[model samples]
Target: MLPSQSNPNPWSESEPAEWSHYSDLETLIIEGAYSTKQPQAILDDYYIDFKQKRQISNIDSNKQRPIKRVQRKRDDKHLREERFMDLPVGTGRSFSGEYGWVSPFIIEVRRHLGLQPDQLPSKDPQLIPMLVEKAAQGIITEAIHIRKQREAEKLAEVLLEKKNKKMKEVWQCCAYLYTLESFLYKTINAAMRLIGDKDHEEVWRSKVGTLGPFCLLLWDDPYNTKVTIEKTLYRGANLKPEQIAAYEEMAKHKNEYRSFQAYTSCSRNRKKAE
Candidate 1:
């Protein structure tokens, strides 16, 4: 064999002597040459720590398994109170030969409160008193239920349904109340269009809690003499970024109405006057 075929860069005597100075130098050199793409010494230390931590964690998990299982089982068990309460009037097969038993009690309560089928409570001082009475009745019913008086079940069901329906009705009425307020204020605003009565607009602005002098942004200018205004229109202008996007969406329908051009002209005149 040629001399070139021999080991080109084999470890020399001095190199081996230098390596021998370190206790595990030979093992380090071998690992560095053929092991993972990490610093072998550091990696070995990390791996040892990782193995110890994993063993500890496995032991901890084994100890906690029964406790976790018990907790899960407890969560799965339904309460007896819930089972009985869930049987309210129309939910399933009528209990004690009655369907929608809540209707009678609801009617009685509504009659006593002097409310019609659609009539909601006025914004009067009596409203809070009525709600308090109803809540008191609910508490009394709960007490009766706790005593295991089966006869009180009918009354309880009725009261519950009435409470639910009353809540729904109150929400609906509040919506209409807001609409009424808007209509009244918007009407007042339209009347003050060219007369420069800032007080009317100020009243609305105050009610709505807006900063500085503000007025509803009119969609179709009611002050326009050229076109006959049909429906009074105003939109809240104190808008956030998200509301600005909504305004742009509604504005896309501007061309659909026949009075749009006349409305635009009137709006332009109002701005010019301002």
Candidate 2:
């Protein structure tokens, strides 16, 4: 005869299960459920807020509960298995096999999915070479697109550097022109003071017929230079008719050609202060 089993759990019928004993297990279970449910609740609240803010039509004012997707363990497994079974397999071939074909397009679908000939696991020999060729071409096309994007980024960087350099050069050119204008004014004034002071006869004699002390040379038909100087002077100095007339009178008494420097200097100084 088989031995009779003794009652091992003596307190099962006599006492209630202790709350402290089950506290940790219950807490863990509750925390897991809360974590999963919290996101759902948040989404629900957001939807409610959105609906409340939106204007409802009289034809569709009633609140309808969301239709949830039914949970099916078998369906999920079947879908996953189908996807795994559908992946393309490769035969043993050389790197540049007759099977390998290039894509007509630069960007194709296979490469986008990260598929490569070397990465395939199967060695099935029955499939047509054309299938592998097309797949390979697709992969290569995606790679080409990625490479082009990288190259474009590099080219953009080079162009940006060149543009910044050009901008800096322009700023420098403007600053140089401003400094040149200021220097020209000072030299003209110094030359004029010397010429007007008859007491300094020797100094006036040496410099009056020449360009100002700072100028390297002057040309008889310096047309472009003259236009630039005139424009600069007009913009720098606020010359009135009376002032222009007075300068013109002085030019008649002195060498007319030599008067250009003096006129420009005075005009620039007057305008600059204003």
Candidate 3:
């Protein structure tokens, strides 16, 4: 049987650091859960106190400047209740489950019976490409499973175009493992001469693997990079005609963006990042 799913994960769902808000009730619950699961050593390493989160919240509230402003959202919620008291229509009728698609706890509690489960088996970064390959079993032919090579090419394209701090850090961390030889024999290779080639990719894969989606989720935070990639990067997959048409429709749809704050990742490439 497929893994049934984590019944009650310490993270609630594996929330990327970007979506974490200090005041969200769901955030409180998840963090509190992890506070229990977190190894004592990790807590000591981070200098977190070994106390109930309730007590920790009390201590931190004195220094927490953000808590002063969160009362306004509570007031707005009260106003919503007062102005439109018709239950689901005014409060709970969220066609989108509030902001639950990206973050958590935007839906009204009455409407939130159970949460959508996290689909990944676990959040391990090393197994990400394997997960994608398993998920893509029937979709494509054998030759195109070179996830790392494509990622390296994408990394190369980004480095050559910008050659800025973020890409520079990526190069420092990865160039030893991800070598693009198409430009190697002729002129001096500026993008750090690759030590390994496509022929020995398993060697590189064992070293660095693909920059898996979990890595992306962790490192893509602006707080970690101080800047993020704005240019479009493409990843191609074999798509049926109907799938292409469906994606074409999605491409035309406008998406609304919302900004929220608190917390972060560890990009080992840069000293200041995490």
Each candidate's clash count: 1, 2, 1
Which residue segments of model 2 deviate by more than 4 Å? 1-188, 207-273
Which runs in model 3 stand beyond 4 Å of their true positions? 1-171, 179-238, 256-274
On residues 156-274, what C-alpha lDDT tens digit does candidate 1 reach at each position? 23233433344434334322222221122232233222121233334323322110001111111123326444644421122345535644665697653211110111122332222
Q: Which ten residues in a row have the lowest lDDT in candidate 2?
A: 91-100
Local accuracy by lDDT, each model: 0.27, 0.28, 0.27
Evaluated against the true structure, the overall lDDT of model 2 is: 0.28
Candidate 3 lDDT score relative to the true structure: 0.27
List model 3 lDDT by residue over 1-274, tens digit each: 0011122332344643222133122223334545567522111012222233221232343321111112223334333222222112111111121232333211211123221243322333333334333212211121134322322333333333322234334324233222222211111111101112234334323312222221222222333434345643322223456545745665585574322111111223332221
Each prediction's TM-score against the native?
A: 0.20, 0.19, 0.18
